[model samples]
Target chain A: MSPFILICVFVVAFLLGYRIISNVPSLLHTPLMSGMNALSGVIVLGALTATTLAGSPLSVLLGAVGVALAITNVFGGFDVTHKMLRMIEGKNRQKRARPELLDA
Target chain B: MDATAYNSIAGILTLAVLYGLHLMSSVKTAVRGNLVCALAMSAGIMMTMYKDHAFASPVLCTAIAVGMVFGLFLSNTVKMIQMPQLVAFLHGLGGGTAAFVGLVILLDIGVANAFERVSACLALAAGMITIAGSFVAAGKLHQLLPQKPLILPGHGILANAILAVMGAAFVMHAFALDTLALFAVFLLFTAGLAFGIVFTMRVGGADMPITISLLNSLGGTSSAIAGFAVGDPLLIAIGGIIGSSGFMLTRIMCRAMNRKLVSILLGESSVALGAQDPAASVSSAPIAPKPADGENKAASWLTCAGKVIIVPGYGMALAQAQHRIKQLADMLKGRGASVSYAIHPVAGRMPGHMNVLLAEASVEYEQLLEMDAANPLFAEADLVLVVGANDVVNPAAMEAKDTPIYGMPILRVDEAKRVIICNYDDKPGYAGVENSLYRRDGVILIQGDAASVLERLIAML
Candidate 1:
């Protein structure tokens, strides 16, 4: 992308992010952070692109590592976030399954 | 198919699916929403693989496969209690990715314009610093590193010196001095990493969560900038989402702590106070539960208390005491003694940390109280039972004006009639301030694992 277009995208993305994220409650901050961490793993795309067009072994190694790191961020981040939220939602389900626990 | 066309198709598709999933994560089940979000993300990544061109590089595929295996293993094995460490680790990896990408781009395709060169530098510096900061923050949170602030003398001047070097690097790169530009990048990487470590090391544990939020945002922004250098819109948009969310979360956390983002970023809050008073630092042996005789004295008070409010913190999480605490609350309620929990927003490592823990332990949602609700009731409370809490209940925050947390809002559990503390040690809380509430008359200290002690307390009741 051109520098001017990148700047324009940055501004719009910033404003859009501010509006969407402000609506999220503090209670979900950890999950939100992790989810975003996964999304940010989008850098793997750049790494892949770099590798495809690479001219040397050094560049290939760098791009490979970049892809690995970014993809890990994406996969691990999202999955772990799911685990946490599952623990939370599972508790609610547990309470529902045994109503007496709530009374107890 | 053209890469741009594929990217646009995949990007737009991921957004549509994830936006709904994101909404559902908060409104409905986070587990399902998170799974769907992950799936959508995976689809987006798959699009990066150009089918016709074939990434015939076996080395690259193997490296990526290794990463996938590691990520899957990590995600599956990590316990919920250690979620902070996992989050920080992944965020650090993201930063590392951006730095790697920046390096590859610079080496493979010599920058054709000033913009590419500058953006490349920006990505490299931002990524390295974030990686270092997130790792340090994770270490501190996991108790692998010291919790105290790591403020070096003359850090402000040192920071400026680093900035000056970065400026020189920018100049060399702008002039197309290949050797000088490469050296400048090296210097920037080291300096950025050093700066992140230095800045974060000095920040106290209480502020570490905020730092984590900011670092995650930095990771996202760096990735976006890296994407810009590579000329990818999809990466930019995803990075934007991650960056903005982290920034927003940091702001929320700051509001919860009643501190400004500017002050937090400036440096350690405790540094200005200089030396802490030596006399106030003395830790006394716990008052109750050590001897069989001590139980009666504490038990008598619990029986007599008309109302008791429980204040929990990170220590409670460590002890796995939430279930036992819930049992004690139930027994107390059975005795016609009013029982409630006072929750501080910043009580645990994350916002609403205590609530989730308690909820998982089957604590009734109604009995739990927020800061605003619990503070007023503290005056009328017959007793305050503190469970592994320290900094939030430190009376010094209100009375001692010179301390870092002086202006910060606290649980005000000291206003209650009497206090009882259950913790593993007397080493104070994350802020490193002595809890004057522990020193107060009529307060009972039960120094044992919270679960075992709470179990004994339940048996006594």
Candidate 2:
């Protein structure tokens, strides 16, 4: 396939993916985002593959750029997730605070 | 065919698998579990880069790994309430990275490519402004900066005019004007940054969530513009998603407060100042429940209640009592009682704050009802259990004329048969006004920690 075809395919895939993800109900967003953040890690692999195989300097540059963004997305996702976990864990402890008296 | 290429593909596949697993988990677990998935994904990405010249050397690999370890430590150590700030910081990082990419591209290739150069310049300006604006917003929310409004020497109109002039300078540079236009662009960027800070600072705490969402959208837009400059479709698509979602979230938050988008944007009418202080007046009313006899009777009557409404608030998020509250709700349901949650839009510091917390608790999406639907049910509810909620249930917002929350939509908990408020103290809400519902003759103020109080209430029931 031509380079132009490859670019077109990537663009179409991105557009379709975005459309499906964005249309999800608000209730599903957090979960969806969490999923996407994980999936976004794939971009790193794509970057690595593209960079390593690039016969041209431009492809290598673009691939390197892609790798950088994927890493950032992954780190950001983890940061958000950890915070959410702490929040839930804290709530559990707070509930156990006066457990003895309540059970009686 | 190269070993490096194979390794990169393997790394990417590993990350993808982890992400897919995270997506499939239950929402409650997913909220916390996604972090681990994200870490794995990031590690995979870094591994793939190991073959690149950037990471091929041992020195580079070590450096990258060290950075990753530090990020992991920070992500784990930071407290939950500070998460939003951390998220904003990450957004800034993303925007700055994209902006840097654009700049590097321009520097590497020179300015001969007009399309790429223009795109890069736009990205740089937008990204830099977003970074500064987000910091100001995060500072205000975190109380690092004062919540008071900061009006420039000239009001909004003048600030906007200046922004326009700066934009013109930027355009001139795009058309091959001398580097002098760059100076104007920088000046305009600084002014816009200040304008964002001043505009957000004046907004009341109730509107901080909206501001955060808006800034988040701006950050995404900057990234998309950067992607456009570099001819990256993935970046544009991802950025667009974030931008649109942020916008929708802001709109939802504004609707919840019954405030118009224009009003919030203008940064006026958020003062929340009232005629006389309700806080001082509430102190003198009565510490002991004056209607103790009635409260006892109501509590006893509710013992065998058939239906209950649980109203949540920012206090719930602060106390992190969502899971316990959900447990209590489940217990009520087991006893043949119908339990439903009443969520006010601006209930927490952000739009859908209560929803996010409740969703984390694995509460049924259907069981969680909006303010409008829940208000009508309160009248028929045998008991109304308010958990760390305030202001939203304040009848003054609905009835009184001389109050800050006046004319604001609120849950009609006042109309319920019996109102049981679980709060830490009789302190005023974020609005700095006492809740009149607390002073109402019928409401019962069960003063204690939200989770503990709910646990006891569950036992009592």
Candidate 3:
């Protein structure tokens, strides 16, 4: 793709993203951040491609480390976000199921 | 896959991600939104692997497995309170990946286009800044580094010099000037690292939200710029989305704290620390004498309050008082008092931090109200129970001009009928501004550990 096209994609995506994310309540800001943090790991595509194209051992090793770190970022971010959401959901269910418990 | 087919699929997936964010605006559909985004991400990854023909690589697969394990272990082990630092650390790793990719691309002799070279330089600098800055932020949040802002001598001048050198190096390397590309890369790397560390080192706890949010933006921008270097449209688009999201949050946090993002980036301390040393004030002035019937008055107000608002802060987290707070709220509800928690936008270490902490304690999500929603209700509230909070509820933010927290939006706790403060001490908060609510006629100041104070209140009820 040409640089012009890439810049277009970036501008369109950023503006659209800003509009969508602005509506997310402060109640979920932490999860929203962690979720976006995971999405930033989309750079793994570049890392994987770099590893595939690397000719030397040092370059390949560095590329593989990039892959590992990116994957860690992706998985760690999503899993933690899932756990946090679950904490809220689980408590919501508990509150529903045991109304009397809270009263006591 | 053909380029058209690949790009088409990528576009659809990007829309799906945005739709997922739309769903995140509401609590009920948020989990499903997360799942949708995760699924889209998984599909995007598979598509990339197929496009790159990387599925068969043993080294790549092994790296993926190791990373998956490490990520799972971290997610499982981290406590709720540690979420901010963990997110910062994860951001660092993501930025590190971008830096490595940019470095590889820059070092490759085959690439000669000026646009690609400039993009690679940007990717490398942004990535380095994100990684180094994020790690410092995480260290401070994790208490590995000192929480106080450490101003290096002539920090502003040093940061500006580094930035100027980096900009010159980027220009030189981009146009393939006489300077060796490798030397230029080294210069950019060093400058990026220095600038990143310099800024984050001067960010204390009160400034954590801004720092973390800014790093989050840099992390995304780095990856997006790397995508431009590598000619990956999907990576650029997704990076842009994440970058914008982080910037939006950063702007919100800055507005909430009444801070200028540029001043924060420049490491300008809001108040002149030496002129208004809170420690000096503490020794010079005695705390206001508690009303002789303070405990009885607080107890009576608590029992009689038909409506109550609980304002919590970083000190609440410090005391690990969320559970006790939940218990206190429950006791109040048992007595037929309607209770809600007022959450300031910058209340904790990160945005929405208090909500997560409260959720962990099983406080009903409905009971947690954002600042704007809870402000008007404070006046109707018969009692305001401040548990370890100071700055957010300090009336001085509105009345005290020229102070660090001046013009900051604070919870209207002082506007309530009767206020009962359960803070660590009568001293100033992280902002170093005295809380005017402490001296108000109807307010009861109980200085002690938050959890024990909540325990005492619970027992009295």
Model 2 local distance difference test score? 0.59
- Model 1: CA > 4 A from native: A99-104, B2-7, B17-27, B51-55, B271-297, B300-308, B330-340, B359-370, B373-383, B424-428, B439-443
- List the candidates ranked by DockQ, beginning with the highest: 3, 1, 2
Scanning candidate 3 chain B in windows of ten residues, the lowest lDDT window is B277-286
Using all chains and alpha carbons, the TM-scores for the candidates as numbered come to: 0.88, 0.70, 0.95
Docking class of 3: medium
* Two-chain DockQ for each candidate model: 0.58, 0.16, 0.78
The true-versus-predicted C-alpha distance at residue B71 of model 3, in Å, is: 0.6
Error of 2 at B7 (Å): 22
Please give the lDDT score at residue A61 for candidate 3.
Answer: 84
- Number of the predicted model whose lDDT against the real structure is largest: 3
lDDT of 3 by residue, B342-386 (tens): 999998889999999999999888889999999999889999999
**Candidate 1 residue lDDT tens string, B1-461:** 77578657755754653463456436355666677767777776676675424256687788778888888888888766677777887888899888888777776666767788888888988888888988888887677886666667897677667767767766766775678777877877887787778767776545766777888889989988987888777777777777887787788778767688887776645433544421122234444446755556777888989899999987788788998888888788888999989987777776556766776676765577878888999999998899888778888888888676776688988888888888766665656566788778878877777788888877887
Q: Give candidate 2's error at residue B123 in angstroms.
A: 1.5
Tell me the interface RMSD of every candidate, in Å.
2.4, 6.3, 1.1
Model 1, position B419, has a per-residue lDDT of: 83
Query: Which pairs clash in the backbone of model 1?
Result: A1-B231, B150-B201, B150-B202
Question: What is candidate 3's TM-score against the reference?
Answer: 0.95
Comparing 1 with 2 on lDDT, the higher-scoring candidate is: 1
CA RMSD of each candidate after superposition: 3.6, 7.3, 2.8
